[model samples]
Target chain A: MPYVNIRITREGATAEQKATLIQGVTQLLADVLNKNPETTVVVIDEVDTDNWGIGGKSVTVRRKQGK
Target chain B: MPYVNIRITREGATAEQKATLIQGVTQLLADVLNKNPETTVVVIDEVDTDNWGIGGKSVTVRRKQGK
Candidate 1:
């Protein structure tokens, strides 16, 4: 069984987009590793911009700083 | 910064339990890898019984079979 975790900054991804992502990641694992899609698990986590940081600054602040 | 993804079977974990897990994982990463907890990302994925499988059998089916 292959478990895939995807993280993205919360930007209001539609349910359809999430579904597509789940499907595509499952397919990619199956094609590359010959894993069974039925046994593959894909979970998506959407983090708030304030909670997600890079280079010691939150994404929200970084974006505001035009970085 | 360390990004940690935790996967567990969906068994109705309480909000407190999840919060504890997130805190513990963040602490572990900080202690062991010297990562910054403020920048550490810990996302927990609780998989459905039907979507999580082992030995080619879903957890739901396996549970039903008492396996």
Candidate 2:
């Protein structure tokens, strides 16, 4: 019942990248936590730059300022 | 800081529905956990049926089997 959610900026990540992430994260949990990979669920989310924020500022704005 | 992730099979969920979820979840965390809403991060993932699995089978397969 281990659920892992990975969030990244929407920057054209390929399907293969997502599949690799899923496999790698599952394997990591199995190796470190003794968790069963069969039951472990990994979900990857690609968020829009406008939706991801830092320092109370959206990523889009931060990128525009080159920070 | 509270980070909440809600996952649902991708099925044409409208922008309003997603916004409501973000607001509702943020409010819930504030009310129950006393977490600051400003610090709370809520991400909603609309996953492909092929990517979500249950009982050793993907949601797509499960639906086809009518289980």
Candidate 3:
């Protein structure tokens, strides 16, 4: 079984979008690696902007700084 | 910076429990990998029983079968 974890900065993704992502990722794994979707696990985690950082700066601050 | 994603079957983990996990994982990465906690990201995803499977059987079914 292959487990897929997707992390995204919380920007209010609708349920439909999340469903699409889960389905697409599952299909990709099945197609590329011959994994069974029935046994695959996909989870999506939405992190708050303040809790997610890049280049030593939180996404919130980076967005404000426009860099 | 290190990103850690933890997946577990949805068994009603308390907020405090999740907080402990986040802190522990972050500290582990910082101590072992020399990662910065401020830039470290930890996300926990609780999967439903029906969506998580092992050996071609969903957790729900396996639980019901007592195997």
**CAPRI tier of model 1:** incorrect
Highest-scoring model, DockQ: 2
Which of 1 and 2 is the better model by TM-score? 2
Off by over 4 Å in 3: B1-6, B9-67
Model 3: per-residue Cα lDDT over B1-67, one tens digit each: 7888788989799999999999999999888989999999999978766555454445666688896
Which residue pairs in candidate 1 have backbone atoms (N, alpha carbon, C) closer than 3 angstroms, thus clashing?
none
Q: What is the Å distance of residue B14 in model 2 from its true position? A: 12
**Candidate 1 backbone clash number:** 0
True contacts kept of each: 0.04, 0.08, 0.14
In what order do the candidates fall by DockQ, top score first?
2, 3, 1
Order the candidates by TM-score, highest first: 2, 3, 1
Residues B1-67, candidate 2: write the lDDT tens digits: 8988788978689999999999999998889989999999999878876556444445566578896
Candidate 1, after superposition: displacement of residue B6 in Å? 0.7
Candidate 1 lDDT, tens digit per residue, A26-62? 9998899999999999999787565454544455666
Cα displacement (Å) at residue B20, model 1? 0.8
In model 1, what is the error at residue A21, expressed in angstroms? 12
* Cand. 1: chain B TM-score: 0.90
Instruction: Return the lDDT, model 2, position B64.
Output: 85
DockQ of each: 0.08, 0.16, 0.14
The alpha-carbon RMSD over the true interface for every model, in angstroms, is 6.0, 3.6, 5.4
